[model samples]
Target: MAQYRWSYTSLQGKRYIVGLFHGPKTGHLMIYVNSKIVQIDFKVFEEKVYSFFLEEDLCEITIKKDNGSYGYDFQINKEVDTPLNRKRKAFNKVNRNRIITMFVGLGVFLAVIITFGISQKRKKEREKERYLQEMLAKKTVSATATIDSVKWSGDQASFYFKFYEGDIQRARIELIDKAAVDLYTQGLPVLKGDEFMMTYYTYNDSTSLKLNEPTNLQLANFMYRAFEQEQKSQSHLSEEELRCRVKCAFRVSGISGLADVYFQAETRESNPWHNRLTYNKLVRDIPFQEAFNEYCLPQ
Candidate 1:
């Protein structure tokens, strides 16, 4: 019998252990964190030397049997020194130097700098929290809308609907990505006359609304395609052009509000960085009427 062991710290700062034991005809492998086994696998012995791959950790392990009993040679291969690793190392070095400097003659200056940095960070965090709270505190309006039209182009779609809130009757448009459209239609074709209940929050100074329902699948297949398309074209286009391209697709059918809702939800969750700043700013202040005139209305 032979035994081998390897250990490494994960990117998330968690320690893990990988152990392998080889007998006459079979080999057993175990992976653990803090002495709690997380994975176990078995392989049939083929030769004196055996190699296998671990998918979870992206590592390869080779074990060789030695002449002496209870002896084995272990070799573990892992990708280290990546860009993230290098950045972490650099950050650690800088932090270490800063700590050392603070302990020396410049302690008062370092203390003042650290205090100012922390104060600024806390102020920004408080501002963000206040913004979210204000948004959530707004009044919610509920109404039912009948889909009057459905338009599709490329990976985007628009739904035109009419609704009545109290005595006020209005026609509204909602935009959705191809993934949301797929979900709304249940893989079937979308048509006019579909209906849904909409609950949205309205801003005080503007007629802009934030939707509160139909949380679309975050990792839909069409979303992946959209990401791929953005990645391919992002390098060639300016920030403004990319923003206009995304906004224009949903704007033509006057469903820009729906697009805003979708993007806002995605930003709150996990949105890609390509044109993110531009898209976020575009939808930040504009109401539905302004967006419709700028992008949807024919000049």
Candidate 2:
């Protein structure tokens, strides 16, 4: 039997059925424009097929025989230029904005890099100047004694105090090393005007003899010994002995390298944090009477 294939376009934005026809005796079947076959019901003596036409972006239909073999053919016009033009316009706007933003960001990044480089250069120059000054100072002082004493002006370590033999009014030079200072000051509560003292025995031009206690441990041991001695003494003590013999705990702190001794003593009295004292140049902590005789005036 002769058959005819039909094709058309849908005006509405939907699929509209076109036509249905008989199968061909030879070659593949071709369906067009939104056309499809609901059923062909092919038997042993029959050959029937189905097909469809599709827009470029739309759905399509297929055709099959009773043996489960299938084929597809699409009828399409040329791709439209309108949608392509719209997409190109959108892409151009986005690319222009992206290029402008990239240029601005690049400028800011370059400015930051320049600023950091300049700051780093200035810092390096300043450090070099400081180093040169320190070197010059060291050279000038290299010929003089390592330890120089201006006067007993401000606070200083007690260990550095100078004392002379036989002379009570004035003294020559006393070099109490750090270890001795720590030992003598141990267990003695911090008192007012506690200070560090250092003496420079200028033997020759470039050398000076310096000696003192070695460590804080030595000082602590000395204090414990003093406390024990005081306890053993049978002297009839007055109010002064009462203060010295009172049980106390100490909190200690100091600067690194420099021998600065700061101590706070908590007495068994009304206030726990009653007495506090600091000594920059700590030599030793003697009884008030002893200290007055040794360092201050005639007894």
Candidate 3:
């Protein structure tokens, strides 16, 4: 084995020791900082001289094999106080400052982008709330009307109302009222042919209207109670079979509007029970001349 050592001192007077070791089949350049091994890589050469630097060119070491011997020759080159060293020191300082400035600028740019995104998100939310308030402030029309039909599409419910306007004119009120949706979802009383008074406001210059008060019709409570009784009495049937039978009964009673509500209530989280309780079940469970009379009869 052959060994060669070179030493360097930085501008701050910190010392670094470097070593080159060669054996029959292996060679490595090693660096030591504060008596601890820092960096190393294997290098192999035959009959040729190799040169390596320590401390970023502060010192250099050259190794050469002897002409007729297995031993090697080592030479050290130390950094001297020359004009070239002065220029190199100045270049290193400028490069370090440039890197620090780049990192600071990048951090500031990322912060600005995150702040802009949050500001835009909040601005959109405020605009949405303002639009909802403006729609609610519109002029309202209150009337007593019989629910002729109820249709549902996506999250919106459209109630067809028959009221006298010189002659009978049909008006559609579409809304996403949470209470009304919850009542229908829970199998509470919501059906065609039900009568109730509603206060609503118009939008799009009277082109559309929506209910804003009394989230659910008052008569729904009576239907809900009758529905519970019928469900309990017919508990023996499977849920799907019960739903099909109830749909048939709604069609027979001329209140097929409830079928739309039933289909809308099906969700991934819960079983569809909106169509499982029908007017036919109420009439079967309670004797009534007509299915609508069962809703008004004493519970």
Candidate maximizing TM-score:
3
Clashes per candidate, residues 3 or more apart or on different chains: 0, 32, 0
- Give stretches of model 2 more than 4 Å off: 1-108, 111-115, 118-126, 129-133, 136-222, 225-299
lDDT per residue for candidate 3 within 250-274, as digits (tens), equals: 4443233343233332443453433
Total clashes, candidate 3? Answer: 0
Residue pairs in clash, model 1: none
Instruction: Please identify model 3 stretches exceeding 4 Å from their true place.
Output: 1-48, 52-90, 113-121, 124-132, 139-145, 149-159, 162-170, 173-189, 192-201, 205-220, 223-299
Is candidate 1 or 3 superior in TM-score?
A: 3
Could you give candidate 2's per-residue lDDT for residues 142-170 as a string of tens digits? 11112223233234343223333223322
On the 0 to 100 scale, the lDDT of residue 40 in model 3 is 62
TM-score of each: 0.29, 0.25, 0.36
Positional deviation of 281 in candidate 2, in angstroms? 30
Winner by lDDT: 1
Error of 3 at 34 (Å): 40
Reference-based lDDT, each prediction? 0.52, 0.38, 0.51
Give the per-residue lDDT of model 1 (tens digit) for 1-299. Answer: 55556776665676666666556455565544446655566763443444443333345454444553334444434346545546666899999989888787487877899999999999999999999877766665666665688788889777777767678777866677877654443333333554456754555421222222222331232233333444354558654544444454345322332233234334433544223453455545455347646764558
